[model samples]
Structures are given as C-alpha cells and as structure tokens.
Target: MAYYTSNAEHPIDIVNIASLENRVKARMDRGAFGYIREGAEDEWTLRENTRAFNDLRIAPRVLQGIDHVDLSTSIFGIDLKTPIIEAPSAAHGLAHVKGEVDTAIGAAKAGTLFAMSTYGSTPVEEAAAAAPEAPQFFQLYMSKDDGFNEFLIKKAVKAGVKAIIMTVDSTLGGYREEDIVSHFQFPLPMPNLAAYSASDGVGKGISEIYAAAKQDFVPSDIAKVKDMSGLPVFVKGIQSPEDAIVAIQAGADGIWVSNHGGRQLDGGPASISVLPAIAKAVNHQVPVIFDSGVRRGQHVFKALASGADLVAIGRPVIYGLNLGGAEGVKSVFDHLNMELSITMQLAGTKTIEEIKKTTLL
Candidate 1:
C-alpha cells in the first residue's frame, strides 16, 4: 500500500486534530517528535501564539437565512479551495519515509497549495512531479553568493512553482532547547538545494552551506529575487507593521506574518498579535498570509476575521503525516475544512469576504 491505515498492531486513535498530535507522538521516536513539537527558548512566543486566538471571542451573527458557505479563495492569482497553505518546514524525512513528497501529494489532494521547503529532503523537481495537478510554491533562502542565490531562484522557476516565498526570518536557526536535549540533527540531506554548489552541482560543502546560511537576508535581497525571477515574491516572517511595510516597499506580492513558528525569537510577540497591525499597514494592497501557531479551524477563522487573507498550517500537518503518511495528511485537511464550514455556518458567515474585523468582538 502507498499509505497505511489503522490496525491492531499499529492502533491509531485520531478522533480530532488535537488527538492526532498525541497519536503521532506515540508512533514516532521521542527525538523526532520533539523536533516537530518544540519551539525556541522558554517557548513563550509559542504558547502565546495560540493563546492570542483563544483570548478573542467570535461574535456570531445569528438568524441569518444563509443556505450555504463558500470557502474558496485566491492568493497571488492562484485559486485555492480553502484559504489554507502548508507552511514550509525543514527535513520531513524525520516524519515519514516519503518525506516532503507525500506531504505535497496530500496538500494537492486537499485543494490547497503545498510550499516546497528550501530544506526539504526531496528535490523540488521530484515533489513537483509527485503532485503535477497541484499549485506549488517555493520557499527560498538567499545565499551569500549572488551567483548561488540566482542559481536557486532560477531553479525554482524552471521547476514551475507559482510563487516565491522568500523567508525573511531565520537567517539562522533558533535556540530550540528540546533539540539540544535530544541531540537531534536532520537525518536526510537537503536534496532540493544540493545543486547550488561546486561546478558539477553534486556537493554543497559544510563551510559553504554555513556561509550561505549566516549571510544577512536584507530587504535588498527581496528586490534581487524579484529582479532575478520576475515571479510573484512573498516575504514571509513579517511580524510587525514596520516589517510589513518594508516588505511591500521592497516589492513583495504578499506579506506572510510569521515568527518562524515561534522558533526564532523566543521573546517575540505572537504572529496573531502582530497580524492586525500588519494587515492594516498593507490595507489590502497585497495579500496577508498568517502562520506560526495555527492548530484548529477556529484559529483559521480568527485569522481571516482579523485580516489575514490566508493561513498556513505547520505542526499539525506533521502530526498527521507522522500518524499515517500521505493518508494521514489528507485526513488532517478533511477535518480542518469540515470544522471551518461548521464554524462559518454557526457564525452566520456565508462567504469568505463576510469574515471581517467586525466578525470578532
């Protein structure tokens, strides 16, 4: 079988999205699970990301005679069945055997876009092939060498990605405490980015890789990427209004409000906390995408109501993938879409546009 189902020997109990996290924890080795579960120092931002959503109350507009609801939305001219995208996480090889490839397939089958990570174990071409029918986006890291950076941008364009998400945060990794405790390191090589070194394009030396990673990714790099590819460029990891405006001025086609899933700055504010101000700053000039601590459909609702054009799921996607691989990832989408629909109906929202700041109290 391409994917597996629950059985007596490998019993699974994923009645809800929250339970799926537990199920995956039971199934995977401790180190691998913590890598997906843990965040930065003290994890203050991580807890606050979700807590910010819970702090808000949805003011339902009852007695509306709405017959149906529409969840389909578009970003960067790409139509999505839902306003959800999978966030780009590194090294999915730890989650399942097929790694990021299976996650791409599941996202495609769910009527959404799958972001190909710059750190994925599978090559971008192979992942694109896995989901030929799905709209794909490429997340990139700007290398110190202008030549190498251009090489990666050109590669993603040649692979046929719809948009380029240039992650503005994590010019370096964060102080993830659990990772240190477990002594965890990525098991698989980053095949998608392996071609950016040497003449033969077979090896990316350790020193060369660190040099690229340590290089500062400034707003000028965003402009360079736009000039290099002429593709729609989205600046991810914009956590404040100032950063959002800087991205827009730098020619960002979209602004992704994120705190690197609370893995970068441990003391930084929640992505949701900064979302409203950033959205107001953009003021509909471009799409605003939100991610960091989205775990439920209600969180998605709060995001759109607060001014996010779309939401990207991170850990939950991995939770599902660990439990059932491709099939598990697909199930996660089903649960989210259904829950979102139900939430909308009860809130008297019949259209995605109807979800506005006024929808929340």
Candidate 2:
C-alpha cells in the first residue's frame, strides 16, 4: 500500500499538519499517532479539545485600511520578529539525525526563539552553540533523581540558556495506545542519566538529591531551580485557570499552555481554546503562550485573539525535518511566515499589536 498520495500541486502539500499526520499514520506502525489511550477510555476530553475551537466564532472588523505591517513582539524580555516559537520535542534525531541542532538553526535563521528539549539527542550546550545568537530556552524534565535534575538545570544555565521551562504535566508518561500496541520505544536513551547521577557538586544548595527524587524526577517546587539560578522561569503543560494562577504565583515568568500536542492525556481542552481563560487568569502578570493543533497562520491569529502572546509549532516542523532535514525545517517556517504576512494583510492589521479580537472572523 502507498504511504501517501499527493495532489498535482505537490507531494507534501496538504491542507494542514493533521492531514499529514493521518497520511503518516497509514504507513507507520500503530504506535506512531493518535490518542495514546486505548479503547473507549477517552471519549470526553480528547473530543472536547477540538470541539471547543469550533464553538468559538471569530468576530472580525472591516474597512480598517490596513498597510505597513509590523510583526514584532517581546516575550520574557526577548524580542522576536515573529510570535512563533519552536515547541520542544524529544529526539529530533528520530525525525532526522541533526535532531535539535537543525531545529535551533532553523528557528534562529527565521529570527524566532527555540525551546530545546531535555530528551533531545543533541546536548543543550551543543544545540545552543549551533545558534549562539538565537534566543534559547531549556526545557527541563524532572528526573527520577533529584541530583540529576539540579545538575541538568545548572548545566543549562551555564550553557547560556536564557530561560527555564518546567514541564509539569508529564509526571508519568502518557497512555499512548499506539506505542503500547506497536511497542514503539523512544529511540534515544537518556545519555545524561549516568553523568547526572555522578555529579553531586552541581545544584547542591537547591535541594537535597533524595528529596528531589521523591517527586518522580519532577521538581517538588519551581523555586528550587529559580532560587538556584535566578533565570526567568516558565511553566509548561498548563491547562486550567486555577493552574495558570498557581503558576504565576509560583513566580513563573510565562505559562506555556499545551496538551502535549494531544499526545499526553489523550483528551483535554485544545491548547488554543483554553488560552483565553488562562490568559485572563494570568491577567498580564506574565505571557501566556500556546501549542497543540496549530497548523496555519489563521491558527496563530486565532491563538492571539484568544489571548496567546506567542504560539509554537510542534509536529509540522517534525514532519518537515523527516522529509528534508535542516532545509525542510527552514522551509516550514518560511511557509508559515509568508502565510502569516498574508493573513495579517487580509485582516486589515499591520503589526502584531494591531491583531485585535476584531481582526478575527
């Protein structure tokens, strides 16, 4: 059977990433795609996430005479030419051998920020070196070892990482039924595990290693890293208004609202749909960013209208990497940028700030 069928326009050209996801699903092992959960276990939350967006109708304004567009924004004191940021994912090497290095370079060349995953095959320092001029944030995974967590944080900070993003939603791995059926395992093992266990000198004062392990590799508190490094901190995997408020109270500089691209927790509110409530809860105390189910410029626009200060792309870039490596990743960003510029022009908005709720329809 054919893995994919393409239109005359192009082989990769499809309506959106979701379509591409479906195409890939047909050829790949069952463990590769869809809600990780099995059976009828996920009926409500998974469906609700996508359905929430449908319930919202964009309210647009006409006759604004838009021209001279400016697409610039600042998040966590870092200026970005565009509001798009690359969402962190594990082992870009699975997508391509270049892994996070390709992603870092692509985001930097496109004049945006890149988030480096702790699970990436490329080391944080190496990824940072690839795009020394680009703004980079290190994503932290609380390890089963507290000492290891501290070591990773200190290493990231020493590597010139500007911000720390704590992924709190993944206390345990998601129930990916696809992986379960196919026995799909993460291609890259934790190479840093032994190094982290041996390094006791780092992150010493932050917390006792024994205390840290109790939380199952997730930090018991964000203050441990914040107080130790004094870098701006962001909390990812946020979904509810209460959690948003809690994150801000915990000294989060930003809240990255994501449902792990619907990979974890098979059913939940779509990241974009809950952005408004989360933003409202934060009340501008910090930036609220989004991920999951975003594929086009309009999706970015919708996110902004719904209160996302910035939006991130996850799977599309991965697909691009799978198809063409570094150049492919760059092409994905370029395509999105062009689409965004056109969307802004049509909405009668000239700049990022001009994209108000009225621009949506």
Could you give candidate 1's per-residue lDDT for residues 298-317 as a string of tens digits? 88898999999899998888
lDDT of 1: 0.80
Alpha carbon lDDT of each predicted model = 0.80, 0.69
Q: Identify the leading candidate in terms of TM-score.
A: 1
Per-model root-mean-square deviation over C-alphas: 3.8, 6.4
**Per-residue alpha-carbon lDDT of candidate 2 for residues 28-107, written as tens digits (9 for 90 to 100):** 33432332222223544544555566665545446878765677888867889888889887666555567777778877
| TM-score, candidate number 1 | 0.91
- List the candidates' TM-scores in order: 0.91, 0.83
lDDT of 2 at 285: 86
